[model samples]
Target: MAHQLPETTSAPTLFTHSHPQGIDPSNPHELSASLYNEDLAPTTRKGRTWNSYSIFTLWANDVHSLGNYAFAIGLFALGMSGWQILAALGIGAILLFALLNLSGFMGEKTGVPFPVMSRIAFGINGAQIPALLRGAVAIAWFGIQTFLASQVLSVMVIALAPGAASLQQTSFLGLDTLGWICFVTLWALQLVIVSYGMEMIRKYEAFAGPVILVTFLALAIWMLFESGFNVSMTTGESRSGLDMWVGIFGAAALWVSIYGTFVLNFCDFTRGASSKKAIVRGNFFGIPLNMLFFGAIVVVLTGTQFSINGAVISSPSDVVEAIPNTLLLVLASGALLILTIAVNLMANFVAPTYALTNLFPKKLNFRTAALISGVIGLVILPWNLYNSPEIINYFLGGLGALLGPLFGIIMADYWIVRRARINVMDLYRTNPEGTYYFTRGVNFRAVAALVISSVVALLLAFVPALHVVGPFAWFLGSGAGAIVYLLMAKRRIDLADIDGEAIAVTPKH
Candidate 1:
């Protein structure tokens, strides 16, 4: 007989079955004390409070960062015209929106973070491996973003006070005294805000989103008037016809790859959403529309820079510093600093906190996990990583390869293997007989699939001769993993047994 969860204020809202007797309350496999902890369980209704606007603000905080701004500038360097770049961005944005919604749906319904949801496919213990991988990636990102924000702060400080240049004369760990001061200050500020918890982070994003939008708009308008109307979208030698179309597609792939990491872990945000409709609606407005608006601003600002300076200037700080008006420069720099802080906290800080918490729930809560992640971020010395192209390529490429398979495996298990009928309670089960406990708390099939796909994708990315497949690395890895897992586990998985039914799952010894 199946087991019924005890009715409690903290119990999640489960979908009712036609026959109430289908659930058995006498089974030993039904519940485990070690598994049903509050931190890893489905989020309580009280915690599911984020509305459409909050979700929108989350994406806004993610997209309006220095890295994204720089990436937008880099797209023009791909030999595409302004119109072509815009088209590519639009297409990529739509694809990303759909992907995020698909990934978010499970979290919305189950009210569990990505790491907890991962248990369904990877087994309870196996989930920790992916969680750690994701947490490590988030830490690297946190470090890089922190360094980027600090650079913006440092620039603003030097711009406002000329005397600050003296501080740059002394160097430590490859960064000057002024750089260290700004980095530590920004890093500590993010830690403090995150320590207050998720609600405070949401509030920060909500306020920062509009300010960032206005700041970019103001900068774009200023550049337009300053640079005159003779702006040309074509920078350098531009391709047209078939060549331009190819470039557009390439640009689109690049755009999609930028959010590859977030695509895998977006459920961390959506789990807090009030409803599925809220997440879908928020993603629509936040992703494609926001990207379109930001792309237009970037194009105009970049075109104006080319027209005035006879060269492309993608760095907002550099652009601001070039302004002859000191007051305007200072104001713009301050706005950029605020934008950076918002992005760093929303995009880089929160996900890892949850990931680390999931890893060791009893010992590490969200605040402690965040503090640990922050310490590792400093150890990575991201300022150096940001400057070194070879290191950045290897690190990001390796991460993409790793994350792609994980995305594929989870989506395949949920949508195909389980046919969207996840036994939410089973996700937390620690019993050897639990459906998710494939073999000693690990799913070897999924791990094998992840390894095989990641190896192929990494080879494509790093091998000089196989460079032709480099652009499609994310798709290749994800598709390979999904197909492999489906083929291997098709007969072993029993979907009908998921909905309030008890089935003996023999452990593979």
Candidate 2:
């Protein structure tokens, strides 16, 4: 049975459209009655919506994390100079911006979250596989980010009370007593925020983003004053021009790999966007311009590290630990901790919660799903995983490899195979006659393409013989998946039958 929507104000014009031929508004049996549930239904325009600024804040929260800071500084070790590194980051940012816009447009048009939007390409039941895969990766990241943030908090605690260092002597589950305290504290905080739902999450990021930017700027200024102006930007490595260029490209690929998962799941945030223009504008500012500024700050601050501390400092926490003033150390640590929490909530927590909810909408709502994700995050024991580079590489690299093919398949389905025309009602239907219910409610062609591409990419990433292409695995997989899916689905897809002007809506079931 379908529940009736409340008698509220009408939705905006962008969301209002005539029902498709097969969808009978008076007869719920012919509509997507099963999917009319709150978790899977299209968002009503009258509900809370995000503008360009909100969208910008989402990326701001994602990019301004301790891990991203470390990643930026680590690029210096790749044998590239200041300008070369900036250029690589800039190129990567542009590519990211373009990809985000494509994914965001899909969300805005459909007014549906990533997992729901995925049904268009993967079929109603088949979409759960990708959704669960993405959720598991996000859960792992949630644990990793939580562990990283707790380390910063532990530093702050030890700085405030020097005697607290004694807690480090007692260890359990690969973490000290103080470490467990901080980790559980941070974990509890994130769970509370997510429990309030997406609106609260949006407000939290909006406030945290500006404060984080300012704090980072302050850190950069402090470093500049201490190091003075005579800092070397060169790596002092004698490599040919071709080798340098290759290194620069490799750096760009690394940056792409870092955010590849977000690129695939961007529709999660963009689903709440007020309009397409707002999402596009937000992505442009949030990605390219924001990254350029961030990269410049990292380059300048890191270049002077040799003068300040006699060596380049890759981790931000290391720089904070070196500070002599306890007050300054506490302030910096708090800021870093807040930034980490913000990133973990947006990038790691929300996506998986929604994905899990999509998987079991009847049994689990947002809050329940979030709690489940949090428990799994702790169960992963991410501190152990973080300490081992081999494990981290295999885990994150494997996840990154899958994202590229997922992105490729979704994009090809939306733009090329379907020509941006979706049978929105059919997406939620279980009937065999429905357009999307291909072969037991699964598109095997897409499944095969994703599997084949991911396997090839993983081989390149893990196998020692093909290590040369490991860095660019994301690009290779995306290309391979796109080409393969297009070729396989060319005959089966009917662009003529699709209605381009149709918009998705939640019919009363």
Candidate 3:
């Protein structure tokens, strides 16, 4: 009954790889064929493909994006000084580091994606809830990011001819004529990239990280030279005095909220890592320092542009498009396309693809699920949803509200309740008697915790009186759920004869 464990997985010698009971990939760990697919299975030792560099590039590519540039400088409108903005970035970095590491642990230790990991906490059948929720949230994010990327192209479109700027006057479905065209154009480009699979996405990410970094730096330098290096911090419509300090902290919470979608599905990426060390090393380089430097540069660019234009510019595309040179505009358009696609693939596309596959594993595969997800992007009206800084935070904060409780339950169940051990085989087993087969194959305690915490969390974000508290929706949901789950589950989780990544892969049944 021995089960193999991943290299970084903490387990006893009783479950060593040299056990007489070797896993049979032919039968494929005897997982219920219904719950198992190539995409849903625990990564085999050799199948663990990503390295530290892969992790580095994944975060680097996402951080250096059009939405993020807008996100970083967006705090300026809330009346924060450069130093206060840096403080917000610092707070966000620490919060995000903990969030990614904790959320990614079960994935690293077991090499199972988020849906499978959910079975550990929510019971086999109940796992579908979070998967569906994450899928919906991801589709919304896909559209939002696509819309942001389209800004760069929209700028290009308007500059192509004098008549193009008039397209803004004609609105359809909340977006102007040029906006709709650019949104669909970038939307098509990202689908092409996502259709190619993870390898091509990886290549795109490696290229994008450097292009955005170099391009943004060059743009920043140009802006600095234009304004004689006089960098201002607060924007035109900033809050005054003590109110400004309050808004700064509130805006800082957005940094964590922005990551709400991926936090629930961090496992989707870490499941492919060679080891936890590789992921940690990559995250260390990719997140905190990268955000600090990249955010600072973008903030400076925004400040310089404001000083020159005498107005606030949220998106970087406008600044890049100000130049009348057709060739530079073309080059910048290509770079933004790369940046947007890279982020969409890694952040928005990958997680939902797995979520959808997990839902209909028997009838669906990766590409089919991905194509459906891409189409979902086309229908979403992101132009209206993501109108301003406050709006984006509110949008993501609501997502964090639901995902936060899920995060709490999953982390608490895995680390505290199960002591970081999971029965990987049972996760896929359809039998009612499986280890994870709580009452009717659904953990009511977890469901109760999710409902209660989500209600309180949602109220915090949506209520007019608690607007200041809304930014901490993720924290509130996570803490409330963790507390409730621990109180409700009285049976001590005995860590005996647990399974890990002893399973391997084969074609689905």
Candidate 4:
């Protein structure tokens, strides 16, 4: 499965080519411009039809997850009117779409995973920074989703045998004994999926996403009907005008922050796409379209739950548990729990495994990397991270602050400064003359922009006066980093530095 280096000629740009006969399996580290082999090429194209549906499946898993619903309802609880909540949700979705579209274009252009494509802007070795950060986030999320999924298992277990609730009293690693068992069980299940690698993950998503979607849609309709047509739920109650607006903004910002890890690694999946056009089409359908539908579900479920319980419950698990006899409740909760775990495995667990393995390909392949990441995630004790609502919000917010700027710097370098072009062949070379190897495999400009912009964003998050601005942290950080990187890089490098004629075009999937 080793990738061959791209064939080079005197021509300044590298074009995609299939490897002749057998590929060298020994040197897995020796990657070329097109990080995919013929075996890895996508199978469908624009007119073929199925590719669009497959692409749509990505968001079904993303939106159907427990975390997605939890965050959306939490935003609704913020001090804003119904219109304001809808505005925040819409704005957040659009912004995420733009970010995904930009990142995905690189994948579509290069036909390479995120880590591979990042080599151009981050340098062959320098790409490790973003890779590691993204990997860490993924691992953390893997542990978290496992814990959340286990809670559903706990519910089912307790329902089956009421005595099992006693296990909750026995403490281990800050979680109850039953919680530990469930976490370990879900963790083991994820390993099984991760062992199969990317293709299986895709297939799992293709299946899980659609089933989960259909079930959730049915669940939402049932809840609305059961609760009656006049379920009254207000968005929020703000103390003052400014406070209300600020809180609403923060709520929206939180949604963007939740997808920080996904935003970074989306290219990993998109790289398999046949074209940039397909990538944009996928993002358009996936982000905004999915979010709109997902929000509808959240609002309906939120209102129905309030009417039934007299309090807003953000977690879908809590909402599901309230329904006494409904089969739909049991099915929807179980499906969501499974779907979230699947997402955790696909989105969070898989990225770090591949990214870390790419860092040390000589000694490690996919399995070793996954084992290391799983162990690291366990060491983090993700259940502890989820113990407090305030702590979880701050933790996610902190990560988002860093991610916003990192994305901005990378995108600015690739799109604005490089003008959507890269020396694909040169990306593999360690030689200083290669386009990516600037000053000992580091570009201080990108690094500086990331640090400065992240600091600004963090300040916005923690400062009391600036806390009101926290909801806009991602926008501020991303905008600042992109602007700074584009401005600074423009002064040092011109469009002429990139060969526009070198656009790589491979045969359609």
Assess each prediction's global lDDT (C-alpha) against the native.
Answer: 0.76, 0.77, 0.75, 0.68
Tens-digit lDDT track of model 3 for 420-496: 76767678766665778788889988999899888888887788999768777777777888888888864665455
Q: Which residue pairs show backbone clashes in model 1?
A: 2-24, 3-24
- TM-score leader: 2
| Candidate 3 off by > 4 Å | 1-28, 157-185, 234-248, 380-400, 497-502, 506-509
Worst 10 residues of 1 by lDDT: 500-509
Which number leads on lDDT? 2
lDDT by residue (1-509, candidate 2, tens digit) is 12232232333222123346643445433434444445556665555368899988877767767778788777676566778878888888987888888888887776777887788888888888778878878888899989988888888888888899999999999999999999999999999999877777888889888888887788778778887765657556734588877877877887887787887888777767889899989888888988887887777678778665557777767777877899988988888887888888888898889888887766676788899999999988999988889877887767767888888888998888888876665666577767777889888989998998888778877899987777788888888888888988745653433321223333221
| Candidate 4 per-residue C-alpha lDDT over 217-253 given as tens digits, one digit per residue, 9 for 90 to 100 | 8767777877885454563453457775666566667
Q: Residue 294's C-alpha lDDT in candidate 4?
A: 83
TM-score of 2: 0.90
True lDDT of residue 174, candidate 2: 93
Q: Distance from true position, residue 208, model 3, in Å?
A: 1.4
Write the residue-wise lDDT of candidate 1 on 1-509 in tens digits. Answer: 11223343332324232123443434333455344434445665555767999988877767777778788787776566788878988988988998899898877767777787788888888988777787777788789888887887887788789899999999989999999999999889988988877777778889888888888888888888988765669788888788777777767776777777788887777767889899989999899999999889878888888888778776666677787887888788877877877877766777788787777665676678789989989988899988888877888657757888888888998888887877766776665666788999889988888888888778877899987656667777778888888887745664533332222111110
Between candidates 1 and 4, name the one with more favorable TM-score.
1
TM-score order of candidates, top first: 2, 1, 3, 4
Worst 10-residue lDDT window, candidate 3: 1-10
